[model samples]
Target: MEGVIDGDTRALLSEDGALDWCVTEFVRVVDARLPPRVFLRHCPELATAGSAGPITPSATPVTLQLLGSDPRGLAANAEQAISQGVTRLDLNFGCPAKTVNRHDGGASLLRTPERVYTVVGAVAEVSQRHGVSVNAKLRLGFDDKQLALACAQAAEAGGAEELVVHARTRREGYRPPAHWEWIARIRAGVRVPVVANGDIWSLEDYWKARTLSGCRDVMLGRGMLADPWLARRIRHWLETGGERLSPTPWSARSDMLIRYADAKRDAGMAEKVIVSLLKQWLNIMRGRDSEAAARFTALRRETALAPFVAGLSDLGSSSDSTSSGTAAHASSTLAG
Candidate 1:
């Protein structure tokens, strides 16, 4: 994803010239006592993205993200990460993956405000000591809004410089009516910068959220994935109030697929891994083209990236990309 986002994907996305900050994949905080080099490996972009060659400017200058549950462990990891030139430390308390939640990372922390307090406090202390900044990403709550305000309060009390709150409770998943109203309440309750997240899949949603939350800073995760230009559009709307965002051209998308496949190959991923990655993106792309949707279904039945790319090339060549796809089309399959 680094090479794709920083290479050809960025190239195609920036053609219209818009987009701001980006965050890398979650660098799992696996061991409490791992070496700094391991952290560096996960955050190699601390140097720059697409360094292999033909460096395209990263879609948004990316911030290295870290995920874990242990306060002391996360603190130690943050210390090493900052020492290695990481500019910002984003604690992931909003990931809804079952594996992560099972381990008490991500959204599970919403079940326990005390734990959130401890973890945020530890990371913020380390960040302050090292002259770095710490931020928290969180969901409403595991079951309801009972713990939502408490979690924000804990994060703020623990020294978080900002909070990114996904509107829905962990149980709510994603449905219509994103509950941006809740984000507004969280903004009112928290003194630090509160970013409105969740359900922001269109320019209208972004504007409505900004108006509702009264917070200028917003986080676009799935929204950006579904439409890479979403952030730039949001930035444009924030500045000029109405930016037209067209979908990626089929020809451009085809070129992007080839480049992504090549980057995956260069990165040494297996053919299956490469295909799987492409499939992930196509889950959203499919909504724009019935042929693409059918091809993705067919590609899933195959075992090689070559066939997948060939299929996409064929489909892309035959169809025209439109701007009327679903708002969630870009991120339909890729979860974060």
Candidate 2:
């Protein structure tokens, strides 16, 4: 999601006005504070932010996410982001990438909940002065669920106003059966509100996740990518007493992809790079839509932007998407 869910993607998805907020991809922090450009690059919305800080064109709040192990450095960068008009912050300890872990970031910190406390405490200290709340995203654990509750409590104790639990251990990767029940355990154990995340791909999944975890809210990830209207769909169901919107047609999805390409082209992105970006989004959509699956199969190996964009106009499906290729950043899946 670090590469996949940048500012443009956030705008497109949040434009429906169904989502409460969106998160920028994690800003990788090491020992030293980063410059304002780093934060802006990850969240271009900041450049045009209103008094409430950076938000999507539809006004959904965008939370700036930081992935790192250094507390003092994270604190300094948190202050830097605050200066740049970021009103919200989230610490990511759920990413399962080996390189991130080996570098002493992400889920690797879950192995010792104490470290979670220290890191979050440092950032919270900075954010509190600005009257901004800090939140944390977490996985079950590095290797198992033993430390899940401990980590949740650690984050809350360190002043996280909310906790988002992506219900799998680092070892589970993105495998299915996301263990929503485990989130229930963590929710019961923490004082701060816990938002259920991971594998809520449809209305049924959302209900199951909320019912199991007893959480009032959820964080959507790949599922939202797979179905751009998912948030709206869920919102409709909730508002209309179980009324179901018609399933997304492939044509709609295609139109969205084409519009994304048009935006990139307007910004002078390379045609070849746009081709790859289209493929990455299609790759995610194929997982949950049968029509998307067929189109992905047809266009899987296509390299030309023209052919790829043309292929999205299939007769069967309808909708709207983009990506950047930084492999480590690419694998940085948050929430789900």
Candidate 3:
């Protein structure tokens, strides 16, 4: 979600005011405190003065996330983030990227619950003094489920106010069947609230994840990218007693893509770079929307920003930017 979920994406998804909060991509901390520019780059919202900390335009809170292995370095950086008005912080211990693991950050530390305590304790100590809350994002364990409970308890003992568990182990990567039942185990074993994450792509997935994990809230990552309206969809269903909204029309999706392109261009980003970003987002969307898939196929070879956006905006390419009876699959295609 690092490259995928940026400030613009957070703004668009949160604008509907359905999501409780949004989190920035992880700020990779190492053995020393990073500069303010680095923190601001990862979370531009921090520079905005409105609430206790960074919040989206709609006032949805934005929690700054940090990822690192060293306690002292992480704590110093945590202090820097607090100085920048970040009231809520999330420690990322669940990233399964090979590069992250090779560097001894993220889920690599899950092998030792003690290490989890040491790092979390360091940041928590800094946050508590500023009246800030610290949260932990975790996978079940490094290579297995053996230490899931120990890790959860260690985080709580180290002062994490809440834990969001991406049910699979580090070994599982982004594979399917997220073993949500494992989250149930972790939830029952921890004192703090546990948030279920991974594989929650639709309203049905949301209900199933909640039912299986007994968590009151769940986190959205790629799911939000695939279907920008996922949070709103779930909220609508819950508020209406199982009533389902019509599938998000293709025009809505295209409008978002075009708006994203315009935003990057306005920021002075190169045409090539903006095109690449749009392609990345469209690729994720293709998995859930047929119109997006067709547009991606037609525009993938394109290099210019204007033409690529035109391809996304064009609704006459046989697919016609219409659901055409694929709405059911887009909304609830996966089977348990």
Candidate 4:
């Protein structure tokens, strides 16, 4: 979610009232302490009076996420984020990127529960001093699934207000069939609330995951990427105990894409970057829509920003016919 779940994506997801809160892309913590501008740069929501970002027609609160190995450096950075009006902070211990693991950050920490405890403890101390909530997101383990309980206990011992477990080891690396049973084990072991994550792409998946993991709360990542209204649908189901709503039409999604583009433009991103991001989203959508595949194939080669935008505009006009069909297809596939 590093490059994918940027400010624009958060704003786009917020449009449907699906997200209760969002965590920003991890701010890398190195040898030196980063300035407040660094946090704001990653999460522009800090500049908003309510510490929320413009999510189309609404605003959603955002939590700042930080990644690092050093206990003190992360703690110091947490202090900086809070000073800038960040109310919630999340520690990243679940990232599986090779580059991040090589640097002794992210899921690599799973091998050393002592270090995890130290890091989380330091940040929690700082957060407590300022009355801010500190949470941790972690995978089951590094390469050993058995170590998951120890890691969860470490996080709880270190004072993590809540723990989010992405039910796979670092070695699994987004493979199908996330091990949600581990989340149930972690929940039983930890005193803090446990939120389950991974491979929840549809309402059926959500129900299965909730039952398997024994978790009422979930954190949607890729599922939200594929379906923006996922959270709204889940919320509705929880409230009314009725059948899940049908997926939003692809035509409606085109409007969201346009809004996302406008958000990036408003944030001063270059047109090329915006185009690249759009293609990235479309590629993810291609998993569910043949029309998206065709559209991405056509627009992937366009280099100029204006032409790319115009092409999207043209595609948006004709998306209605395929919208419902595409949504049904995605839902059936995911549910299956």
Residue-level lDDT tens digits of model 1 in 65-89 = 6788887788888887777677667
Q: Pick out the ten consecutive residues of candidate 3 with the lowest summed lDDT.
A: 327-336
**Which numbered prediction scores highest in TM-score against the true structure?**
3
Q: Write the per-residue lDDT of candidate 3 for residues 24-131, one digit (tens) a residue.
A: 889999878789999888788877846568988877788889999999999999999999889888999999999999999999999999999999999999999999
Comparison by TM-score, 3 against 4, better one? 3
Question: How far out, in Å, is residue 186 in model 1?
Answer: 0.4
Error of 2 at 163 (Å): 0.3
Question: Each candidate's root-mean-square deviation in Å?
Answer: 5.1, 5.8, 4.1, 4.5
Please give the CA lDDT of all the candidate structures.
Answer: 0.68, 0.84, 0.85, 0.78
**Which residues of candidate 1, in runs, are more than 4 Å off?**
1-17, 48-56, 237-243, 287-292, 315-336
Model 2, span 8-90: residue lDDT tens:
78878777678888888888899898988999999899999878989888787889999999999999999999999999999
TM-score of each: 0.83, 0.93, 0.94, 0.90
Overlapping backbone residue pairs in candidate 2 total 13
Model 4 poorest 10 in a row by lDDT? 327-336
